[model samples]
Target: MGINTLAFLLFFVFGITVFYLLPQRLKWPFLLLLSLSYISFKDIRGIVFIVLSSLSVFLGGRLFEKRNEPKDASFRKKILILTMIFNLGVLFFVKYVKPIYGAFSGKTPPELDKIPFFDSIIIPLGISYYTLQILSYLLDVYWGRQKAETNYGKLLLFTCYFPQMIQGPISRYGALSAEFFKEHRFKLHNLKFGLQLMLWGFFKKMVIADKVGPYVQRIFFSHKEPYGLTVVLGLIFYGIQLYCDFSGGIDVIRGVSECFDVKLAENFRQPYFSRSLGEFWRRWHITLGSWMKDYVFYPLSLSRPMAKFKKSLKKKVSRVTVNRIQIAICDIVVFLLVGYWHGAESIYWAWGLYNGIILAISALLTDVYAGWRKKLGVDPKRKLWDNLFIARTLVIVTVGWIFDCSKTALGSLNLLKNAFIISKTSFEPIVLNLVDWVEIAELIIFCAILFKVSRMKERGVVVREKIEALPFAVQVIIWVGMIQLVACFGRSSGEVGFMYANF
Candidate 1:
């Protein structure tokens, strides 16, 4: 029941109608039952995820409470760490190892090795998401940033909130716990906003992302030696494909949550408009980046070795071990983990390392280059040059996506070589005349609309508010038009799932 599917639409409409009609006190339990039913409908194995996640949070909170009673913070920390490891371990095993083993060995594990009666472990939908959310909750308790939820049902609801159960902006316990217990009320404004956002998401996913998919798939799956220019174009298409797919999914999740009168975190902000890799990350998958920063990077930076390094550098060797260097190393390590978090594949690993290397080099040269420019009285902030630099950075980042999408290191290298290294005579054109013109036109129109929407968002312009203020008939017409476009162009086959679902 992916958010993009017709089944999800029906389920969501039914859930919303029942939720608003039910007594306030019964809403949580009703939703809980719905969640369970939804899970059962999708796959019985999802129940395992719900139970495991709920138990982990329930026990983790209890353990934290116990440690607090004894006043042994170290013991609590150890428990939290161990709990995280176990959760992640389970996640890793179910998501990666078993599949790889089955792929290679062509034999199932013995019954004794299996997970209870489930002949094979089915990594439930949003396991990675919920697991991370649960771990973050435990860690928050350990850090004293949030109190442990003693109520099992409330904690469970936090983990399995149906609106965010599948794809999430990864809500924190502190942020969502109160909302779970509070009485939800239906709001016309929220409903309107949510539906509008969902419509836009469907547009991005079904219209834009799916449209680009065929070109990308055709080139990548062809297994022919496509020319370098075509390969470059394919990589650019993939970058757009990923952005539209993942962010579009987030939009749908957010919109659905809004209909429940719950506000989920925004996952993306016009990331393509970012001027640097660091800035891009801040905008892209914002929830995950925020989690990694708060839970991983900050703690690691404040750890003994990094702290001592900062101290020693402040007193001596000022040029060698700067703050950026420290941050770059940490960024590299975090991104390496981020890369592998997608899957246990060499290509993914290399993709992570590639970004790490790029960021590290960028950091290392930043201060030196800035200083040199200042000494020469060159304004590094000049708009023209800044725009050029940003353009170059975008190209660099797009090239990085080639490695991310490629199946092997050699394949990535060959694509890059053909795209940039080979002479003109050796080039092989992949896009025939009419298709090329259509793609180019589509790309232009998409970019123009994207630019306008991005600017509007940046400016805090509420197009929806204006729409709502318009005559009801006008709004209905617009809605009808949106639906017509969706009906005509949306990916009806359901084979094109969200890109982030794989992660």
Candidate 2:
């Protein structure tokens, strides 16, 4: 069940109650039970696949460790390779196999139906997320960063921890298990903080994201094709819709997880305010970027082939040029794979290349840009300079969203080209005639609040702590008012699901 739903809320209330009531040892097993139970509610097929995936990696880790008798490195490498193939193979089959096959065969595969495993092409919930966690665990064991888990249950708990099992701030075993197995007392502050975070998430989801989503979908998919100024408006709203939907869901998940005294890693960091495309990525999907950096980018950087290439390139060019070229190569490859991770869609790959090429150019031009800025008497600490970069980055990111929001690469091009027109959009008549001005006003006020809060966070203000510092009665009244606003506005948002859940 989605965390936003009433059923999941009730389930969570009950589960948290049982969690706190249990003894320390039973709590984790009970958590495992809850996770397994929750996934079963999502799909029986999901539960079976997750368990199988978990077993494959868990066994691989154990076997790899065992092969370390006299450190038989080759056998361990073989085990690691086979294990990666099995796990990544599953990811590829479920996520890519259908689209790739459908492209070639021009029809759905009967072979998939013939497989006895699942009834239909049902991709498991959080397969992309959990598979990353599982691989990270196996790799950690192989690298001797940590020992393999002797108990499958504990390992499974790490693999399928419910909150992180959703759209994740992907965790590694060494960092996560320490938090997982530790003792947690029921603290008033933890509850207050978590609930407050959840409330903010609910506001973003129910009020902002859900409200804007329909408008975005309608405008993007209209029979008239993409609009002009309307296309700009739709994409701008889409950016807001996407961020709140994904990050808001994450906030709810992380907030609730915090009540258990386990804080997941931060996923977002005022990404829109970032100064560069690279910085935007570093802030947005923070964990996924870090995972790619550690597992993919750094490995490519240090590998022997890259070493040889760097040497050859340095012979033809300056060392600085070589480093820039290296950055270009690695960033492109990493982001290309990352794009493919989402799907085999043309738009995704185009979006990936778009970002990669810009980031690479940004790297190559850094020294020149800094000197130009110096000559222009531009200082980054000044407001205008910072805002300029922020605006530039937002435009770059939104341009990528043109790709992300469209059905295909050509569709994206249509939107971008249409975006330049000054003519009246056909969608405006519908917007004016049918739109609710009251709801629009509410959106404006809430958006203002959201921007103000984000601005405060960017400025290093701890907003929740500020709330806590207010008079207790005042805090109660303010919270009561905000909660009521959410309830009132959110009711009209209907049951719009989190956008990233499809991934």
Candidate 3:
């Protein structure tokens, strides 16, 4: 069920309440049951796939652990390879088979109905999310870093943990397993803070994201073909919508889990505050970037071939230049995969390369830019310099979103070209033409609130903690007002489900 829906809210309330009342021994079991129930409710047809994937990882982990001997090294390697193939292959075919097939074939592939067991299901719910989670578990086990759960059901519970299944922070096994199996007691502080966080999340998603999303999408793709500032305005609105929708959903998920004293990995920092594309990625979707770094980038960067290349480069270039060259190569590969993982579309691929290339350029030019800045008497640490970089980074990131917001690479090019061109629509009240002034005003007010909140967070302010410190009656009044804001202005962020859920 969509987390933004009232029905899911009721479900969460009922589940958490019953969870607290359950016996200590029964807590995890009840949670497993609820998680499975959620899967069953979402797509009964997906039961077979989820079971097979989780069970394979669980058994693979057991087999790997048992065969931990020098003599069994070859066997262990084979097991890991086969298990990864099976898990990833299923994920790929289940999720991308149609688009990928059509991409090459130039025609619609045979209907999925012809495929066994996949007839009724397209992409299985959480298939994209849980696949990475389980793979991380399998890899950790293979590397002898973490122990596999002896009980298959417990491992299954970890994979199907309901709160994070919708759109994940892509948590690691060691980090989340403790939170899952820990002895959790109900605390009034958890309840208060959790609810407070959820309220803020609702404010972001309903008050701003949902309100801005439709209008942005309409203007962006409208036949009137918006240009210049109209395009710029749409891009900003889209950026806001994307962040608030994804992060707001994550906040709700985290808040609910926190109610159970289960701490999920955080998915976002103040990403927009980042002054570099590298920093933006590190800050945005914090878990996904970390996952790629740990699983993809580091491994590739340290591979024997890379080691050889790095050694070869040292003979011809400075140590820093050698590292930059290695970084450029590995980053290009990582970001390409990152893009393809987002979609099979050329636009996504281009966006991925744009980030990878820009980051690489920034790295390669680090010394050059610093030298120029020094010569120009521009202190790199100056506030003006930092703000200038921030602005530049924002523009770069927003340009990448044009690719994301478009249907094709060519479409992205058109949008980018028009995004900069002067036209009659450039200074017009184009957004007001799209929606009423009341909505425009509401968006302004909410966005200003969002900016203030984000600024405070960037400075490490705990806004929720501040709210918690308020008098009980004052807190009640605040909650009531928050609820009223959502009630009156909410566009139901989940009316169409979260944007990231598609990925």
Candidate 4:
């Protein structure tokens, strides 16, 4: 079930109640069964995907365990790598190969159509997320950083936990497997906090993200030439839509996990407030960034070629210069992978390359710019000036959102041109008439709430504690207001699926 649905809400409440009433020893199995039931509720065929994911991890773990043997280390590493490739291969084949093959061949592939009707390959919900989690687990096992879980159910549950089974913070096996098996006692604090997070998530997704959806869709789908202000506003709205949609999903996932007394990793940390692309990566999709750093970038940087390049460069350059070069190279590789991870499209690749180039340039010029400012006696630490710079940087980043959302390179350029050069008269008749008073009102309210949350986020105040400090009457009123708002304004025509679900 979609996270933002009435059915899922009922399921969550029922699951939580039954889970809390169960005996401590029975909780894990109960939750596992509940998770499986939930998956089955969505599609029975999903079970096949789950089984495939579980078996992949199970075998990878077994192979990793054998790597400790003196005579088998080399063979085990090879097997581990092969296992990872196969797992990723499954994900790639299911999600990408057909579309690519059809695009080139002008017809659907016979092999894809030949699968049994019952077992026809549909991309499983959260395959990308769970596969990454399981692959990381296998890698950790191979590296001796974590022991392989002996229990098959725990491994299965880790990869298919109901709350994060769809979109995820992509929790590591080491971080969550033990907790999955542990007995959970219902804590009043956790329940209160979880509910509060759920409320805020509803506000983000239903109120902010959904409210902006029509405008974003219209701007992107329009075949007519766009006006400059319309294009700019479209990009701005898109940036807000993306953040609310993604962070909202994570909030719901984290809230549900908390109800079970499990703490998932935080996925967002006010990414828009970041001053640079480098800082933005650290804040946005934090779990993925950490995964890439631990498993990819660090290892690659310490590999023979990179290490030798660094050593050779060090002999001819200053330490700072060498460091910058290393970071630039690593940043480009990581960002490219990050882009490719999003989709098989050229647009995503371009988006990744764009960010990488920006980050690389920023890193390369940082010292020179700092020295220039120092020479001019400019103080970057001044709050007012720093805030201005932050605002300007945010605008730049928002404009970049056009690239992320565009369907093609030419489309992106046209959007940019419209955003900067077109006169309002060209499209004023069509665009100006599309504005809705209700949506505009909702957008204003959402902006106010977002600003409040952003301020709380900046001050290091916990959102849960803030909500708890309010009187019971106030809390109840807030919840009632949110429910009413969602009922009144939530998209009702059709399912407004989470945007990141496609990934």
What is the lDDT of every predicted structure here? 0.78, 0.85, 0.85, 0.81
Write down the worst ten-residue block by lDDT for model 4: 111-120
* Candidate 1 segments exceeding 4 Å error: 69-71, 99-119, 308-316, 319-322, 372-383, 422-428, 433-443, 470-474, 492-495
lDDT of 4: 0.81
Candidate 1 lDDT, 49-147, residue by residue in tens: 778767876798888777785568778777777788888888887888864665466545563256453455677877878888888888888777888
lDDT of 2 by residue, 318-380 (tens): 998899989989999988878887788888898888888888888888899989998999989
Per-residue CA lDDT of model 4 for 37-83, tens digit only, reads 88888787877887887887787787678567889878987888788
For all candidates, the clash counts are 2, 0, 0, 0
Error of 3 at 249 (Å): 0.5
- TM values, all candidates: 0.90, 0.95, 0.95, 0.92
Candidate with better lDDT, 1 vs 3: 3
lDDT score of model 3? 0.85
Q: Quote model 3's TM-score.
A: 0.95
Question: Which residue segments of model 2 deviate by more than 4 Å?
Answer: 69-71, 106-119, 425-434, 491-493
